[model samples]
Target: MSEPAMSEVVANLNLVRERIAEAAVRSGRAPDAVRLVLVTKTVEPSRILEAVRAGQADLGENKVQEGGRKADALAGEPVRWSMIGHLQSNKVKDVLRFADEVQSLDRRSLATALDKRLQSVGRGLDVLVQVNTSGEASKFGLTPEDVPAFLKDLAAFETLRPKGFMTLATFTPDETEVRRCFRLLRDIRDRARQDAPQGDTLTDLSMGMSGDYQWAIEEGATVVRVGQAVFGPRPLPDSHYWPGAAGTA
Candidate 1:
């Protein structure tokens, strides 16, 4: 596939920002309340740099290796990297090298690994717990019912700061179903805030993506991981990463 022209990239980014502002206003929130994390899973580094030069600063990737490479290539550029996919314990060190934040933190073991590695370097990293609100088998996140206990356990990891929660809503055309997933995540965050010791600091809700970010922002998403909306559609199918996305897309 041909790379998107810089103009096209800039245009798409502006449009996504407009939509984000509109959604924030509709929800009675400030436009700056929502942060856009551009997902560059399969996008080339050169094209991603085009986006960086165009004013995008936060870039998210699903795989540790791929994101590490991009971070290395753009070492001097002012961009923040986020790991937005399920992470394996073995890759924590590599991920820490570039990932400013990990949005897919779902279990205690992963947290343990991250904390150990961050302690080795005497550094701290931000993280958002991933919740599988849709209850999808293929999705990787803590069950909504398990989040409170998870958050309580997370308080032990001093180096892994709990920034907020992240989730992937159901891939569906039904607005009601999609909204239900987002609402579940928000409700979970609210309840956790009241119950968990560290919940007060869990302010960021990393939800939404290219297809449903507007609805996500309306439901209280503080950070939206958008890809195709700003970079154009990926050459590979969405189902390769998200099951059930083919029909929805």
Candidate 2:
């Protein structure tokens, strides 16, 4: 497929931002409270730089290695980077170099690995727990039943801060069902905050994507991960990052 004209892409971004603001208002939350994390998966760095120049503060990259490469390329750029897909334990160290926040801390093992890496670097990692609200067989996340133990175990890692929660909306595309899942993540966030240790911080609810972010915002998503809406559909990468020869979305 041919690349979209930059002007068209920029116009689409404005429309998405307007929709996000509208959702925030409808949810009785301040529009300023929500942050947009443009997903730059298969998008080239130049297009990402354009979004940054246009006032986008955060960028999400699915692969740690690719994200690191982009971070190195834009070393002086002022965009905050976020890791918003399944994180491999092996890539923990690589991710540490560029990710200001990781929003897919779904398993206890990954959290432990992250803590060890952060401790080695003498810096804490900001993170959000991913919940399997949709119960999808292909998804990776902690089930609701396991949240308590996960949170309790997470407290031991002072090098990682629990910022919020994240999840992929189901593929069925039911708006109400998607909102329900987002709401569940919000509730989990609240529960975690209430049960957290005295010094623990839980402030964000990241449970949206390009398709249903407005529903997420209406249901209380402080952060939204959008790909196609902002950069247009990503082109397939030259190589894949995982076993299926496919990269995370």
Candidate 3:
């Protein structure tokens, strides 16, 4: 498939932003309160540039290596980079090099690694603790009971700012379950704000993805990660980028 024209991408982004605004308003929250994070995993840099030009000030990449490459390519662009997927402890330093915020600080080791890396850089990082609210065996995150203590330990790291929480609801086409998990994250965010260490903000819930983002917004997702909904279903990895996976274009 040919890359979308810059104008077309901008139109699509505006439509998605409007949808987020509508969802936020329906939930009795201000539209500005909800931030749309364009999930750039597997997406070409051209689409990423389109999103940046369209006023998507925040972009999320799922892998550290991929994000690092993209960040280098898009250096000097007006965008905030977020690590929105599972981050390995050993990769923390590389990930923090371009990550303005990390939305997947789940394990204690990862947080500690990030803390050390950020301290070395002499910069503070905004982080959202990933919670496995869906109870999926494949997911990595702090359980509900582990959150408070995790927050306490994280607060000891001067360079790590515990801004909020993030979760990936089970990938079923079930809005009810999605909403339940989103609501749970919101409740946890509230509790974190109330119980967090002396100076933490505990705001910014980075929940939901393309499929269930409406439910996430209704349940108070300050940031939503969207990919196909904006760029269309991704081109297959091993295929040439054109119609019918060939040179028909």
Return the top candidate by lDDT.
Answer: 1
Residue range 1-249, candidate 2, lDDT tens digits: 999666765777788899999999999988777988988877778887778777887899878988999998888999899998788999998999999999989888898899888888899878888888887666778898888788888888899888777887665566777777888888877787778662246778887777788888888889988877877655554134322222223
Q: Each candidate: what lDDT?
A: 0.86, 0.80, 0.79
Model 3, 17-46: lDDT tens per residue?
889899999989998789888978777788
When 2 and 3 are scored with TM-score, the better candidate is 2
| Candidate 3 backbone clash number | 1
Candidate number with the higher lDDT (1 or 2): 1
Per-residue lDDT over 102-178 for candidate 1, one digit per residue giving the tens place of the 0 to 100 score: 99898999999999999999999999999988888777889988988888798888898888899888888788998
Ranking by lDDT: 1, 2, 3
What TM-score goes with each of the models? 0.94, 0.90, 0.89
- Which run of 10 residues does model 3 get worst, by summed lDDT? 240-249
lDDT of 1: 0.86
- How many backbone clashes can be found in candidate 1? 0
Alpha-carbon RMSD, each predicted model: 3.5, 4.2, 6.3
